[model samples]
Structure formats: C-alpha cells, structure tokens
Target: MIARKFWVLALGILMIGFSSSVTAEVPEIGQKAPDFRLSTPDGHPVRLSEFTAKGTVVLVVLRGFPGYQCPYCQKQVHDFLLNGDKFAAAGAEVLLVYPGPPADLDQHAKEFLAKQNPLPANVHLVVDPDYAFTNQYGLRWDAPHETAYPSTFLIDGQGAVFFRKVSREHGDRTTAADVLGELERDKAAHAH
Candidate 1:
C-alpha cells in the first residue's frame, strides 16, 4: 500500500509539471514582445520587427471564421476604424491579426473586410495561417467554433510590451481609446 501511494504521488507531481510546461504565458509588461512574420491578404509579409523599428505597434488578435464571421470581432474592428486617424496621429501602426484554419483563411479574411470601410493606410489586416501567430503569442482558443482568444498588445519602438489584454470570451476586447491612452502615457513616461 505504501508503494502504491508513492507511485500515485509521483504521477500527480509529474502531471502537474507537464501541464505547467505546456501552457504558454502572455508576455508581461516590459518583456520583449515576440516577433512574428505574417502576411496580408494581398500576400505582403508584415514583420513585427519592421513595425517596431519605426514606431509603436498595436497588435490585435481576432477570431477568424470560426465556422462563421464573428460579430464581436466585426464590432471591435469597426471601433478601431472609427479612430484610425487618432491612432495614426499618435504614430502607431495598428496590426489586426485574423487567425483561423489555414484552409480558405484568406477568403474568409477578405469577406470580413468586405463588411467594413476601407481600412486606413496605417491599419493593416494580416492573416494568421493555421493559428501560428496565435499559438506563438499564447492566444489560441483551442475549442469548438473558436479560432483565437481576442487579445491586444501595445509594443513600443524597441519591442517592449507596454500594455496587454487577453479576453477569454467574445467581448471585453481592448478598444482604440484604451490603446491610445496607453500610448500617451508611455510617451509621457519616456519623455522624462
């Protein structure tokens, strides 16, 4: 009986360690944001480092074609579109990441864009093929009818994360105003 108990304890500990190692943590504030290279629907490669090299980057991960277009994602994109000028005026590049299965992902992203106004020049919509970028950023939803957890991160010119928000559900996503506020705060902080 003592040997059996010892085996059970060992198994439990092993399981705990394995699970912890498998889960990826979101990059914390001040941590270097993970650099990624994803493509726009038109096949242009958008590299995170290139954007960070110039100015602040607002990275937004969206649910893409989880069997159907996500209304919440649409709303969030619309909100950002409304404030496009503000984001550009702040010298920030807004990168919208649409993650889904690789199959026909580009068509779905195009359809999603069809429903919205022409994206501002400073705002670019990039596709995350097969959830590669999502998984790298630890935002994959990994469930039925889900592509990725809605997430937003503010990375400065040096690639340091200044703000982050990951929403488990459909709503509760970070807004343009929220990111703009963070940019102002970061700028002021660095001015000193």
Candidate 2:
C-alpha cells in the first residue's frame, strides 16, 4: 500500500513537470513572428526572416515526433506541393516548420522530404527541433496526444502577422488552397 502511494506521488510530480514545459508555449496572431535559424536535411541553414521577400510570409508549423508521421501535416505539405505554382504567382513565400526535441529532427525531416515535394522557388522547409522557435511564437502544443496544434501564420515583410490559423484538433488544419486564397485576398486588400 505504501509503495503504491509513493508511486502515485512520483507520477504526479512527473506530470506537472511535463505539463509546465510544453503547455506554456502559446503563440498568437497580430504579433511579430519569431525568427529562427535551423538546418534542413541537407544541412542548409534557413531563417524565417529570409522568406519575407517584399510580401507576406506563410508559416506552416508542423509536428515532428519522428516516432510517427502525422497525417494532417503530410496532407497539408502535399497540398502545398500541388499548388506551389499558385503561391509563386502570388509572390508570397511559404515556410514549413517542424519542431521537436533535438534528437528526432534530422531523421524526421528526411522522412518528411522523402516523398517528391516540388515546393515553389520561394518555399522553404525548416527544422525547429527543441521548440526554440515554436515556444517563442506561443504555438507549441506540449500536451499528451499532441505534438503541436497545426498552426499557420501570415507575416508581413516587417515581421508582423496579418493572419493566423490554429487548429483546435489534429484533424482540422489549414490547406494550400486556403493559404493561396488568403495570400491573394491579403495582397488585394493591402494593394487597395
């Protein structure tokens, strides 16, 4: 009986520690998007600031557990590939982010890129393992049964966000069509 009670206390402490570390990250819209530098699978270092080329920058925050490939992320990335040209036509940059613990990043990023992904010339896939960038943006999920809530952000060249989408569940997410449509609308609105 004593041993069981002791085990319960230990588990409770661990849960508290785990929750604090992850649940604290909450990125919001209309704020300056956090800039980060991370390496791709081929060791190319990419930064969020680099994508803001005279227009809005779309940031796709993905979950990178490496133990499992997330379906929502895969679908969203695939959609981006299919509509890459439309985004290019709009003159917007697409930046995909995969965040996790340091150890799983490289392997998971490779698996992520294994499928033929024809991103637009302005699109970039970035690794943000360790949640360094995610936590700063307040978009880290950090809960059980979640890597991160699938979130999308549209940042202006000055690094200010004009639009953001954060899914309440893994099944709900922003897609390529949605992003392209948004880019068109924002550009039109600002142009006027």
Q: Which candidate number has the best lDDT?
A: 1
lDDT of 2 by residue, 1-192 (tens): 999999999999999999877643444666777677877766799877777657778888887663578877888888887877887788778888887777767788878878855556877887877776777767778677455668888888888888888886776788888887888788889888
RMSD in Å for all candidates: 5.3, 7.1
- Worst ten-residue run, lDDT, model 2? 22-31
Q: Per-prediction TM-score, please?
A: 0.87, 0.80
> Residue 14 CA error for candidate 2 (Å)?
21
TM-score of 2: 0.80
Tell me the spans in candidate 1 whose CA falls farther than 4 Å from its real position: 1-21
